[model samples]
Target: MWRSGSDAGAIAIGVVVEVPTPGTAVKHPEALGADLWRTDEPDLDEPRTGIRLQEIRLTSQEGFLPRVVVKADLALSSASIITMPNGTVFPLDATQANAMERLWGLTTSQSLPALPGASEGQRKLMSHYRRERSNTLRLKKLAEVRARHGKCVCALCGIDDSSKYPRQLSERIFEVHHLLPLATAATPVRTTLDDLVVLCASCHRAVHATSAVEDNYAVLAGHLRGES
Candidate 1:
């Protein structure tokens, strides 16, 4: 559920806006536009849906617990349905996670992309794991992504979809603001993916307006390290 219109002013780093299939991701002919609706196409480009898993195989809690989860930004993608060890599947793609830690919690207890607090060396180490895959994640892993981003989602206006405040969030028009900027030499070396934010245009604008800066950098250095 994606939307349009970038917050033209007073923006901060990109949202961390958790939308619930607010709008359609608009269709086009070139590149991803043509295949926007097809998942597992190996290259749909309709925003490669990312999920946040609780645990590929963990947990004894009740309610939608199947050791796997997937949270894609798209409102109605197929990645939401998860298959469990018992052949029991739960459809929760539109679901949101408790927090970034909750998302990462789903990851194997192994090294992954660095958290916002990771050290410089650790950032580099995690970068090795920070991959941009298409048509690969399962139910559990999808849930993990949602949980992580849900933690740092930028505060929205009038109403905020705070973690646990809602169940699932569709991939709204959250922008990709690079804190360690994909380009430029002045970027921080220790910047982690968490350092970057996928914010709604309005939230991003509010951050800048609140801070009174000109650059698009999500200088969220001072923002809360957890959910807003």
Candidate 2:
């Protein structure tokens, strides 16, 4: 996809897997709104259920965009990575290596007829991937905090996991809460350390119990301290 065009400002890359046909025992859930292709197309070497990788690129004439919205879901096929222009690599999952190898052989030689933009189905799938990507990014930023501060602690209640539970149990109970949800953002926004807070499951649920909570950790903290 990198060699597609010089003006490529943004790109979405994902591996595709076949959905089970009707009356077949289900394995993977149907890739809801996958970019399906025709088996009878001249591009196929033989007639079979075909799965083509989906790619969406933004070839903006307005020049370089500092940030572009790209979405992905590793759960569909756990063999993918997103490498940025800066050389930073995000390794998603290594479990599906064999499946990816087979998919590569099937799709590498097939050429697709060029279309103007993303199809409606592709756009719908992109929306799903975007939400997943947003959550994953938030978790990554939260992991960084755990690495630096050394343990998970509720930012509002000041209850450190290490203080309340055994090591293994404590790790499982903590959750990362985003101060501002990605759905509310007007544009592509990068997550930062200051934007996430560690909260125990109970606190996390309480924070989101009402619409007025507003994803504001500070407000939740104030209420907990009887100051709100």
Candidate 3:
């Protein structure tokens, strides 16, 4: 039997596992997988299934034959689980879901003919990877900038939207710009704060107006300053 509980914005799922016969080899529930777990209940609420899980915590009961407690960032549904070759069902990890999404894109692109220079599959994969990587880095950059400077300001235009608009609105206007294009790296490269610059919406758009603009930050700043 499984029971669901919620406390302070976290949902916890209590799983009860039957003890196997004596001398039978069994894996500890917590040892199954770091990101995914199997659940027997399937007839959970059908409407709210497939919610993305951000983090999960597994705790063991302090008794003989301990039960496992799963606390997740969001509610989980059986629909998010995958059936293995042995017929056991396991919940899908967030990382695995992302990988599956990319695989699906590649699989669908197989039906379409390749483009002349870059194939549709390649474009989709690169775009997806860059978007995900940039988003993660952008959030980190924003937090770091805010912590160190108390506010985010555009490096090029020298505009501090926080002074003109509400904090939430001003934050939306600022973006983290990458000094080097993510696609240019031949292999995965470690990104540092030095590789990022804060820019407001307008200046960011201008910087991305052309491929050349990315490499000419000085020129863009000069034009913004009305300098010849």
What are the per-residue Cα lDDT tens digits for candidate 1 across 115-162?
687544221112111222222222223334458654434433322345
Per-candidate TM-score against the hidden true structure: 0.22, 0.39, 0.44
lDDT per residue (tens digit) for residues 141-164 in model 3: 888888887888788888886678
Candidate 1 similarity to native, TM-score: 0.22
Candidate 1 lowest-lDDT run of ten: 7-16
lDDT-wise, the better of 2 and 3 is: 3
lDDT over C-alpha atoms for residue 116 of model 3 = 78
Q: Which 10 consecutive residues of model 2 have the lowest summed lDDT?
A: 62-71
| True-structure RMSD, every candidate | 21.3, 20.1, 16.1
lDDT of 2: 0.50
Candidate 1: residue 74 Cα off by (Å): 36
Model 1: CA > 4 A from native: 1-145, 148-152, 155-170, 186-192, 205-228
